[model samples]
Target: MYTRILVPVDHSDTSAAALAEAIRLANEQHAIVRLVHVIDLAQFAWSANEFLDVPQLQSSLRESGEKLLTERVQQVQEGGISVESELLEIWGGQIARTLVDDAVKWKAHLLVMGTHGYGGLTHMLLGSVAEGVMRHTHIPVLLVKATESK
Candidate 1:
């Protein structure tokens, strides 16, 4: 019964699985897919050195994020699913928060994302984005766990 499905893709294999699942669901339900890719400059801030300009790095990151979103959007569209996409840039804060906000903005009925399937110490240390979204978002979230490829 979902009219809009929000998918957060990060150009990872896990994310690919999530997107594929979203597309299949969208096709089945005759819904629209809203794909998002967030460019958080904070991730690269520490890598910025005396030789690198923060502004330039941010721009580069935005470009790559948009490219990733575009590729996903194209794939979804080709699958006969109605699709739209956005490239977001946030200076700080968790990516999960950003996706939740975007889901509200787009009036998404569902959220689909990829989880790394980490537990215990690793989960505590890395902090799971999928877990954060599941905890904070109001809509139903479907998490697809991605594992290492051989």
Candidate 2:
């Protein structure tokens, strides 16, 4: 029933796992996959714009994101799935919020992403993005961890 699958990949191993799952689902359902990569500019997180040209840094980040998306899109296409991609730039560290917003804007039926599977202290400190998305949006989310259990 899910025809619009949104896959947010960060080029990590866990993200790769998520992409694989999304592709498999897409193949089964004859769905379209939208690949998204959000560029979080760390330099803007603190007071440090003097050394970094904002536009230049943004451009560099966008280019890197595009490259990442291009490779993943190719892989999905080769797997016999239709795909489209976009690179989102958010200056602050609210990446999870941006992702949720993008999902709505794209009219995505589902969000398939990777979770680091952090727990306890690490989870408290890092604060999971997948978790954030889940809390903020009612959209059905399929979180694929780095590894699977038997």
- Evaluated with lDDT, which candidate comes out highest? 2
Please, what are the lDDT tens digits per residue for candidate 2 over residues 30-147? 9999999998776554667877687787778888899999999999999989899998877676888998999999898899999989899999998999999999987899999888
| Candidate topping TM-score | 1
Model 2, position 57: C-alpha lDDT score? 75
Off by over 4 Å in 2: 51-55, 148-150
* Candidate 2 steric clashes: 0
For each candidate in turn, the TM-score is 0.93, 0.90
Candidate 2 lDDT = 0.90
lDDT of 1 by residue, 57-145 (tens): 88889889988988888899899998989888888878889989999988999998998898999999999889889888889999987
Model 1 CA deviation exceeding 4 Å by range: 46-48, 147-150
